[model samples]
Target: MPETVFEVDVDAAPEEQPDPIVNRWHPDVPPVERVSPGEKFRVECLDWTGNQVNNDDSASDIRDMRLDPNHHLSGPIAVDGAKPGDLLVVDILDLGPFPDNEWGFTGIFELDNGGGFLTDHFPNARKAIWDFDGVYTSSRHVPDVRFAGLSHPGILGTAPSHDLLERWNERERDLIERGPDDETAVNHETHDDDPPLALPPEPNEVLLGDMDDEAVEEAAEKAARTIPPRENAGNCDIKNLSRGSRVYLPVFVEGANLVTGDLHFSQGDGEITFCGAIEMAGYVDLKVDVIENGMERFGVDHAIFKPGNVEPQFSEYVVFEGYSVDEDGTQHYKNANVGMRRACLDAIDYLTNFGYTPEQAYIILSTVPVESRIAGIVDLPNTCVTVSVPEAVFDFDVDPDSLAEISSEGRGRAARPS
Candidate 1:
């Protein structure tokens, strides 16, 4: 019999209704049954903005958007028997439409505002308008090719840490106190009547210019360590995180808090345009279960699974920035692509032990490996690489039973926090 995994609806409700689990921060002992390798559960996910936008939308609509504190994720379902330092294995089946009609994801504002690497080139204005058809075709594009710009949530994280929350609270307060930078004397041509402004630079807040290198480094380190994703979940934008591939994520806190809302119908590898995969009212089905004495929590950061091999092949996506030394004793900029090639080579070497011939591996990689993608290159240098190898790839004759065994073993290994 074909193994049947659970399918998450992806489109359910806006999560605007009052359910204790919808927006709360605490973990819950869910009502779902324990999931095995073949068994699956469906989760209904809410839109990122809780269904705040309409079909007839504009840049102003998103710009004036208010992100609510109370408006957070739905399920952090305490996996049955899941303990601290265990990985929550998730199989991403598919991501598609819901009952309602809203297409694409959000978070373009951040990408435009230098929060991401492409901010410099990508226009910070609301470029396109999504209509009722749920398809965003361009009037300027070539004929017959109706390109519907799909988008997904770029930010889906758990609840915030206490210290981080407190720090954020202070930042909010500073913003409220300082208000917009109303310095008319220093205003530039771009400074409109209502120019955007961030929080005031407090002594303890982010270090300003002229701070010592060590101090600056300390600030960056603190931010990286203490700051969880927007909410506590972490910057998890795995588009494949929909519902088929049993995904294993590390458990940082006692309760493996999971916030699922960033829903995208179809997104390209890099999400290059910065605003495809966009949709608001949708649902995600999930079953949060636990693993006993799990050991691969850290490995959750870089999920490694072999397609057919009994000994799972390792796979990881890493971005590297390249700098070449010029003849003038100075460093000249090399393309990020060069750096990506090196990283890809390294990853290939890692997978070689799992049974990939260099040639076979190259072909498999060329076909399956997703390049130029960014889980988050906002802070890192340009080069970004995202790759995945199924456990079955190792076995020439990947039968049903073998597939099951490999999947289960990968899951078992993945469950243990590394």
Candidate 2:
């Protein structure tokens, strides 16, 4: 007989909610529910924005929104037999059409707020509405463009062990101490005071039911805000992790307190400007199991996954290259950000020629799955970064020869290659 499947609704009201949604992963956060090994279950997820912005929301809505403690995730579903030093294997089964609607939005962040690639060129905030029709998405912002749905959970991971938590906190604190002027200082706010953002654990406000004082104190520190991807796999927004994929994450705490959320209907690599993708709330079906001593056996410390059926389809691409040297030949080693910025500008310039405004071009660059590659780093004077957009995404015929010439003509403000 097939294994029994469990269901968790992350958006249900406090009293009615079955599973709790957490903003940060903490080993001490009591599991809302527990599952036996090799169990199948379904989790309903709110959008990355915690459903703060809706389909009808305007660009102004995005601008005024506060995104701190971002990426509301559901459940620290403790596996019955999992323990530290084990590997948690999660098999992604499906993603969804939201609960009430079948639509989502893509957005561009304003320039003043930790700007993204091409932020200087396009400063204004913008949003595009996408209507999902079966397996494809249509956007009004970019007319005559339809692409296959590449849906997946943006955040998936297990809670940190006590040792892992201390290591993270110490490193983060050291970084902040060294650079007091840096804007990325770690916020030390505890999770106790704030009302649960998405779905609070049942019998709310008691995250640690009967844990010892030491465990409770460690949980209070809270794993460094869920922004960057780490060994336990928080916010590793790889777009290829769709249905049928299998992700293996290193287990830290006992029971491998597996947690996930931040479901995206579709997104491109780099997540470019950061404000948007086809952001939507939906359900995810997963099968969970564990591997004993898999971390030591594989010689891998971080999360690794085998993608399902998602792959780039375009045979030919229009490639644009960017260099890191100044016009006067001053070399800036390890300045890949500069190279990436130049590539983005070149992409914007190329898109404008096709009747897209600079803002529209920026939005397209962020929302579309344009591949960015580090073409050459061996060249001493200048390193090369290349951004390639698939020719298939466009309706009109694209001549690679013509685009190559155009890309060379307007290669940002930096000096061209000799």
- List per-prediction Cα lDDT, in the order shown: 0.37, 0.67
> Which one wins on lDDT?
2
Clash count list over all predictions? 63, 0
Tens digit per residue, CA lDDT, model 2, 1-418? 2332223343553223344456655667777678877778877776766666656536776666655636667777788888878889999987776546678777776665434545545556777778888767877666655776678888899888867866776676675445432111112232333222222212212233234557755654554566667789988878888888999999998889877878777776677777546787778888889999989988889999999975547677788887775333444664565576678777877776655667666666666667788889787656698988777766654554555555544423221100
Name the weakest run of 10 consecutive residues (lDDT summed) in model 2: 181-190
lDDT (tens digit, per residue) of candidate 1 on 1-418: 2122212333333322333223322222232223443344554555545554544434554545543322334444434444456665544443444655544333344332322223332334332332224433321111111333333333444333446445655675676566643222112223233323432222232221223456554443323221123334443443444433454555445455444554655443343333333444455444344554454534444332212111112243333222222112332233333333444454445443334333222322322223343333343333344433333323232233444444322322111000
lDDT of 2: 0.67
TM-score top scorer: 2
Error of 1 at 208 (Å): 32
Candidate 1 accuracy as TM-score: 0.47
